[model samples]
Each structure stands twice: as structure tokens, then as C-alpha cells.
Target chain A: MTMRSVGDGKAEFYELLPGREHVTVIEPRANPFRLDLRELWNYRDLVLLLVRRDFVAQYKQTILGPAWHIIQPLLTTLMFTIVFGKIARLPTDGLPPFLFYMAGTVIWTYFANVFTATTGTFAHNAHIFGKVYFPRLVMPLATLVSRLIAFAIQFAVFLGILAYFAVTDAAVQPNLWVLLTPVLLMMMAAIGLGGGLIVAAFTTRYRDLVVLVSFGVQLLMFATPIIYPLSSLPARWQFWASLNPIAPVVEAFRYAYLGQGTLSVGMLLLSALVVVLILSAGVVLFNTAERTFVDTV
Target chain B: MPRPVIRIENLSKYYRLGAIGSHTLREDVNRWAARLRGRPDPMPRTGAAEPETREGGGIWALKNLDLEVGAGEILGIIGPNGAGKSTLLKVLSRITAPTEGRVTMRGRVGSLLEVGTGFHPELTGRENIYLNGAILGMKTREVDRKLEAIVAFAETSQVLDTPVKRYSSGMTLRLAFAVAAHLEPEILIFDEVLAVGDRAFQDKCLDKIQDLARSGRTVLFVTHNMGPALDLCSRGIVLAAGQCAYDGTMNDAVRHYQGCAVGGRRQTR
Candidate 1:
């Protein structure tokens, strides 16, 4: 590498964005934190742009445009209401069946979408990965960002439905617990991204994991609180089910918005701890994997 | 003079070609169990030592290589395909790691291993320049300021707003090379990307590289074409069978490379 601080009008030609520095730490050796932070800051705008691309591409050429966001969950909620609520006679803890299932679906869809997309970071983008030198973590980060946008749109639809129900029915009252909604959302994103990192790290070495990841995520949805409320499960089963990381996230989400489900502070704290542990381990594994994955990938 | 911008010490990269699936796991486990029992790990068999020459099982992509590229020196790496030229660049660019060595780069390095790397098919050429530039570690404002020059250099100013997937192959290379070369990175590395476009475009790329070199940017040029390497490089390094066979002045290195090719032809005959 060479350094030329020439003043031949080259530097003057470009408008230096405020608060942005051309930071290149020429290290004697590679460091993890420095590399990741440098990449994140340098590519902040591109990250936003890629997120926009994912958001727009999903709607392009579709007749519904952004309405599909609401339509998808609405249709799924209706199907679950009929199939599980009426046919299977599944318990909904005395809460309205559509509201209960839609709440869980809203949380589960966000986690599942981010997880499935991020797990295939290596295999799906091998062509791009093979030729570029950016931080490998950027791809997964981009996936999380894009999924957040979709989740926001979907969540808006859920709110619109909830608001309609509140207006027509005297039993429903807008609750103050809605303020905790952002906290629940962060927990869901963390778990999804952390789990994705673990799967993506392993998939680089094992191609079988790629197919298994999709299947595994689908299987995990049943084990999670997606279809049934926590009160429906027996006491012993509830304890075990709550240990699943997604359980607390889903319950917290429902409790915050609908004010009808259970949210154990113990379980939520445990979920946060699990997310941190998984994210730390994933970062270590992903960093090590990034150093040598080009060969295997 | 300034310290060596790139210092490579005895770099080596080894690869294993095990049987399909996880067939080698059983033997690897057995070796681990043996080692636990105070015995040698016998799974390595014959190819474990000096792995570069093993035919059916493993091969080294680089071997015990020592090199130092000084700041502001334009060094060309010339070798035939599978001679580990790309692998070397991959290691240097931090896209891959060496098996048994370390490298210290003194400044920012940029590489264009292929035309249109990381170019989103759905993104317009203008957006792709920012995307690719950021992927190459350039800030958005830098790309914005150089936007016009990049489009002009690529000769696709009219199509800057058009999606890259709509562009021809020649146009793709034009836009990609323009963004990479004009990004003003401290070290610029090219891997045969100049082969894109017509003869005139190729010459234009060579001239651009020459200008970059004249401006005192360190460049590591990888190409099979000796003509361009000889014309642009102050020094040349030749690799053969995963090892550096020659490293000296361009004239001497080119002669050595030619001699090896003739010798290889004779051996084949």
C-alpha cells in the first residue's frame, strides 16, 4: 500500500462529508473490532441502500404493492383461525383466536424471515463473496436490516387490525404496555441475528446444514409460541417451552401489544442472556470462519 | 525510503482434497484417538509432508514464499493459470488467509479481481458505483464527487441511471474498472480485468494504470499477458508450481518466465 497526500486538486474536488473521516488503520496485524467497525461505518449508506433495494424489489411488479405485506399475514391469520381455532379446537386462553395467532405470527415471521435469509449468506452469495474483500459479516447484517423493514410494514398491518377491533368492541382498551413494544422488537431481532450467525458460520463447512436450516427453522416455529398461547400448554410443558429463546420474545411481544398473554421477567432476562452468549460466540466463530472460508466456500 | 508497504514472510497455503462427503472423518477420528493413546497421528499418510505435489489428495496453492513490496513500486505478478497467481492475490487482499505465514500491509489496499464484483443486478449503474465503491472501502461522498468522472471514464454516462443487468459485458467492465481505478486507494491491485472491452478500451486501461503508477501509488498487477506487464511494471515476479521462480527487474523476470515456458514445452515434447 502507498500513501500519497498530494494536493493536486484531487482532495478539493470531493466534498468531504462532515463527521466522516477517511479512516484506514494500517495495522501491523489484523484486529477484529477495528475491521468490523471500519466496515460498518464506511458502508453505512450502502447498507441503507441495500435495505431499500430488498424492500422495493419485494413489491415490484406486484399488483398490491405494499398491501401484500398486510394481505399475507391477514390470510395466514384467517387460515390459522379456521384450521386451529375451529377445526382443531385449540385453546386461545379465552382471548379472540385471530388476535392471539396474529400476534404470534407477527413476531415469528420477523424472526423466521431474518433467520432463513441470513443462514444462506455463504451459499447464496458465493459469487459475490468469492470476488470481493468487504467484511463478510456485511451480508448477514444487510439481511437483518432488510427484514426489519418488512417486519415494520407487517407490524403496521397488525396494529391497524387491532385498532379496528378496539374501535368496534367495548371490551378492548388501548393499553399503556404498548410502550414496551420497541424493547420486544429488539429482543426478537437480536435472537434472530444471533441464531443466523451460528447457522451461517457452520454452513460454510457443511452444505447439509443449508437444507437442514430451512427445515429446522420451520420445525422450530411449532416449538415456539407462534400458533398457541403460553397459557394453553400444561404447567410442566410451559416451563420447558419457555426455555426456548423465541418463547420469551413472542410472549413479550404479545403482552406488550394485546395485554392478554403472560410475560415472565425471568424468562425474558434468560432470553437476553442467551442472545448475548450466542451473539458473542457467533462473532468469534464467524470471524475465524471469515479468515479461511474462501477455500471451502 | 519508506518501510515496505507489504511484507510477506515465508507464506504458504495448503489444501486437502478428501473423498466426497465426510469420508475422511473416520480416519481423522482414529488418528485423534491414537494421539490420545501416546501414538503418532497416522492419518496424514504420504501427502502430509510437502503437500504441494500430491496428485489425488492434496496440493499447496502457495509454498514458502518470501516477498516485500515497497511503497510506490508497481509490481507485476506473471504466471500461467493454476500457478497460484490468483491465490496469492486472494491471500494478500485478506480475502483468504495463509496456512503458515503472516503479512503486514502498511496502508489501505483495493483489489479488482473481477469486473463487476458485488454489482447488484437490480441496481442502476450509478447506485452500483456507490455500492461497489463502499464495498471497496470508499465513502459515499467520495463516490458522489467522482461520479461524473467514473461515468465518463466508463463511457456510459447516458446509462448511469440504468440497471447494470441491462448493460453489455464491455459496458460492465468499463464501469467496474472506472470505479475501482478512480477510487484512489493507496494500493491498487488488478487481476486481468483489463482483458475486458475492445483494443482501444484495453489500451485506455493500460494508460490509466500507467498514470496511477506515475502518481506513486503502489500497484500489484496480476496478468498472464507479458506485453502489458512489461509495459506497466517496474518489477516482475514469476510463479511456477506454487513457488516464486523469479523476482527481479522486469526484463530479467520476463526472460526467466519465457525460459521456463520453453523448458516446459521441451519437457512435454
Candidate 2:
């Protein structure tokens, strides 16, 4: 039908027919945590494109390219080895000191990178977010995926060092628990994503949280069993350490690959519960914040 | 009668005056407490009140807006600055939520609120096409199909592989516009993007918008250039002081806008 005049002298109007799909109604979100899985699935390609953009844009104009990914973690591990393992005389629970720190650093770097990137989702992306409309979660989700690519590269460097120690040193041995590496990585991602989303949501209105997050993450690293094994702590302290969701994942990762740290099903379950709670809460808050964050951010 | 592609009912958007929102947690809590105590909000009103009546406080960017667009209607939105044109588009595109009321759309909406919206300077033009296309909700395959047309329309074939940072402002705008033009959504919203580029490119954009309308896709266009608005749109809406001042045929709306611009009395519908 084309535009035409009606008998009433007003423009002819039309009513929607029933059963035609593709209707989109814009209203206030009824449920804050209601995830539009279909929308996210439809935007999967955008997610991949953003992942590519993040990965490429990060190293553009850099001298070393993706080598910087490996170099960053390697350098950090070196400093930790010198300060914590060498000078401070920290014990690695009989495992090789270099390998011990390497394992922790690689996993922690992945978590920290993902957490930091996701935390900046609103502030860092205010430009794009202001001018366009995409599922806001895509930005943070893409950050997580892109950081995983960097993590993969760094993990390979860690594996190379682990391999060197496995061959050259008699004390270094990886058990079947090494197979739980994927699970450990997933936990790290969940915790980072959840924690970052919570912080990102808060930073939308209260920007002071952004500064807090930057330093808070660094301080949090010390509290986790990253530089020290959980076994080295007293029994009472170990129980408290396990309460930190990241502690078990880090401990399990080391216990899996290096076979040095303590691993308990009960602690793993508790960590999983914390992950679920944080992630659900974060998603709810993030979804709510994203709706109106452009105005505030 | 054709069905309306879009319907907006009593939409209102209230924005705080100076700051974005609550500046601190303490302030937010105080505001929340005020709401609980059933007291008036402490924020000042800060939007265009009435055509010549100036008041300062928290402004309602859009207030009690009710509108509808029939499928295939190329509706032009003409308004002065601070008239809520962009705010209406933002609400229609779902970029921002309305403080009151609701909007319903019968199809997917593609908005080009600004050119080069998500274009990264470091990315090559070709890469940005895919990235911008995806950001506009186009599938990769869709972008693939339109890649040749987009490059030709933009006339950036030579610099397709070069980073966007090196491109001139005109070239970047053309490329960004080309990608947006090819999005092929059922409903399209554009806000002053044609203000860029040379005259020839502006003509091409108007022609493209006309083509999109002829193909039965609805379009909500916001622009200050009344010539194009009258030339391209069958229907026009004039927004004044965050409210719809005139809604009629393009000719009448242009007259109403001209009258308003010239300090004549507003003719409200």
C-alpha cells in the first residue's frame, strides 16, 4: 500500500497485522538480569570482529607485535622470581622456583588482563557506546576472548619453561591433575569476567571505583596464592585464603601442573559457588547499568 | 492501509543539567532517600522549556512525545538545536531509555547517528567496513555481499587496505556513510550525517535514502537542511522545545519550521 489521503482528510493510517515476526519493543527492562541469549548469539560475528580489533589494535605500531604478549608475562615472571623466589627466599613447595612462579604468573596475568579490560568496558568504550547500539556485553565479552588469545601465547611460554624444568630438573613432575588445566582456566575467566563486570557497572556513575579497581586488583593479587603456595600458610590462614574465589583456582592450577599446592573438592565447590554468585550479580547489575550508562558515563 | 513500522507513545527523557547523573555514591544514596521520602528531586531542570520561555534546571530532553511512522514512510525530523531531535532518534534506536512511556518497532532498526561511529583509526578501511557493518547489526555475509558496492560508493578502493588514520576527513566520512547506507535494515535512522562530505556525496546520500524509502523501508531522518528534507520526505515533523510543534505534509512542516525560525507564532497540530 502507498501513502494516500483518507476520507477524513487526514493521512491514511494502518494497523499491524498479526503473526508477523521481527517486532522490537523498547521499554524499561523488566528484569535486570534477563540475558538476551538470542541477541548475543546473533551478534556473535561482531564479538569475533571486536576480538580481532582488540588483538590487532593492541600491538599496532609496536616493534615486537604479538611477541610482546609473551614478553610481558615472561618479564613479570622474571622479576617475581628474582624478588620472591631468589632474594626473599620464598619456598615453592619443593618444585622448581622458576616453574612455580611461571605457572602462577601466566594464569594471574590472564585473569588480571581480562579483569582490567572488562572493568574498563564502560569508561574505555564510552565513545563507541555513545554513538552506536550493540549488546553492551559484547564489548566485555570480546575483551575476555581477546585476552584469552594473549593468554594462549603466554601459556605456551610457560609450558616451554615447564618443559625445560621437567627435563633438566629431577624434582619437577606433572601429574594427571594437569588435565584439569582447562577447568582452571575457565574458572579464572569466570571470576575475572564476573568481577570486572561488577566494577564496570559501578564505574558507570561513580568513577572513583575505576581508580579503586586498578589498585584493588594489584592488592588482590597479593592476597591470592599467586606468589606463595596455599600449603605454605598455616591451617587457619589456608581456610581464609580458600574463601577468596581466585585462591582455589590458582592453587588448583599449580597443584594440577606442578603437583605442589593443596586441592580439595570442597574448596573447589565453594569457589564455584562464589563464581556463580558474583557472575549472576554482575550480569544483573551490568545489564541494568548498560541500559542507562551512556547518559551517566 | 499499511501498518506503521514504528510507534512512540508518551515518551519522555529527563536528563540532569550539569553532570551526567549522580556524581557520587553519597549523592545517589541521597537521591534514593529523597525518592523514598516522597520529596521532589533536588536536580535542576536543564532542557529547552518553551520556544522563548527560558528556565534553568534539569531538562526534559523529550517530553510526552507521541508519534507513528508508517512502513515505507520517509519522515523528516526538522528542529533547531536542543529541540530533542537526536534524543528522539536515540530512544528510537534503543541507545537510550525513555524516562516514561514506550516505543514499539515492527522490524530491525539501523541507526547512523554519526559517521565513523566505531571506526578505529588504526584499522584499515576494509577492516573497518566489516567492523562498522557488524556494529550496525549486519552479518559478515551481508557486508561481504555489499563490499564492492560500498567501496565503489565511497570511492576509497585505492585506500581500502590503508589505515583509516591516514585518510582525509572527507574520505573517512564517505566510507563510513557507504557502510551505513548498505546496512539494509527495515527501519533506518540518520541524524545529520549528510552535513559532511562534498555536495555530490550529499546528493548521493539523499538519493540512497530515497531509494531505501522506495524499497518499502521506513526512514526517520533528522537534518537542518530543509531543502533535502522537503525534496526527500513525504511527511515532516518539527520539534520545538522538546515537543512536537508540527506534524503534517513536508511543505506545511517546512513552513511551520520557517515561521518558527523567523520568530513567528508556532502553529501546533
> Number of the top candidate by TM-score?
2
- Steric clash pairs (candidate 2): B44-B57, B44-B58, B45-B57, B45-B58, B46-B57, B46-B58, B46-B59, B47-B59
- Model 2 TM-score (2 dp): 0.91
Model 2 spans with C-alpha error above 4 angstroms: A1-20, B19-22, B25-57, B264-269
Report, for every candidate in turn, its global Cα lDDT versus the true structure: 0.77, 0.85
lDDT of 1 by residue, A9-105 (tens): 2342222434432323221235443335655666777676667667656676679887877788889899999999999989876667888889888
lDDT at B108 for candidate 2?
Answer: 72
DockQ of each: 0.29, 0.50
Task: Give the TM-score (vs. native) of candidate 1.
Answer: 0.88
In terms of lDDT, the poorest run of 10 residues in model 1 chain A is A1-10
